[model samples]
Target: MTLEASVVHGDWEYQPVRLPRDVTRLNATAELGLRSRFGGWELARTLLYADGTRKVWLRRKLSRMREGAAV
Candidate 1:
């Protein structure tokens, strides 16, 4: 997952920001109760904020492999 932020006025420039991968892990463990059960995540929903920002929710199963894994 990726995030992009941009200035709404003046230069109106956009920049890519880096987020910690642990966010997904934390959400899975704390919110979804999948701490020891899930191996991956999937996008569940998205919300647009009034400040032109977005929030996303994700979910995953207990036994699914990540994409492009060697079998």
Candidate 2:
């Protein structure tokens, strides 16, 4: 998966996820769950298009993270 992430606001970082029309609901939920389970990501926003494609945003708290430093 490609990551298109940036600091929007607050103490959180966000990633945008795109689910194609062919993906099933169960698969999508599992995918999101995996992100949360292993990547500390949470659902931030979602939009479902008329063509069945979905756009999802996932966010995780920064918690005092610093660039070039191990958390």
Candidate 3:
């Protein structure tokens, strides 16, 4: 079996003026983590307030098929 790996990223911004009052600023990171996990991604790194926004890095492996002549 051939294996392939890829990195995924998720980001969220906290806009005090545009976002709803019920939205917590700290929850941005948590939300990103949960969403990534739900998509079968593993958390690789957490960047808080990087460039004034929350950033998350995730990684996952997948199976790849090789093109070859059938025996």
Candidate 4:
């Protein structure tokens, strides 16, 4: 439940997504796909930990139309 700060690189914004070790592969894939399909988040990067945890970076285009609405 640790939320990290979002990063803005050029015209894209990146958010860190944590996949716990307990989640199954099928569930994870479906969930990520849902996020991409509905939230406009795309896979940017990923790091697999030794304990089977995942640290993923989801990126999307940055829009300045609203304040504090990029999360």
Best by lDDT: 4
Residue-wise C-alpha lDDT for candidate 4, range 1-71, written one tens digit per residue: 23368888888878888888997889878988998999889999988999999888999887776335644
Over 25-45, each residue of candidate 3 has an lDDT whose tens digit, in order, gives 666547645646675556555
Q: What RMSD does model 4 have? A: 2.8
Best-performing candidate as measured by TM-score: 2
lDDT of 1 by residue, 4-57 (tens): 542222322222333344455455346434422452444555665565544555
Residue clash pairs of candidate 3: none
Which candidate, 2 or 4, has the higher lDDT? 4
Span of 10 residues, lowest total lDDT, candidate 1: 6-15
Model 4: lDDT of residue 7:
83
Clashing pairs in 2: none
Which segments of candidate 4 are over 4 A away from where they belong? 1-3, 64-71
**Each model's lDDT:** 0.41, 0.81, 0.41, 0.82
Report clash pairs, candidate 1: none
Better of 1 and 3 by TM-score: 3
lDDT per residue (tens digit) for residues 21-59 in model 2: 998999999989999999999999988999988889999
C-alpha lDDT (0 to 100) for residue 5 of candidate 1: 48
Backbone Cα, N, C clashes tallied per candidate:
0, 0, 0, 0
RMSD of each: 14.3, 2.7, 12.0, 2.8
C-alpha positional error of residue 12 in candidate 4 after TM-score superposition, expressed in Å: 0.6
Q: After the best TM-score superposition of candidate 4, give how far the Cα of residue 46 lies from its true spot, in angstroms.
A: 1.1
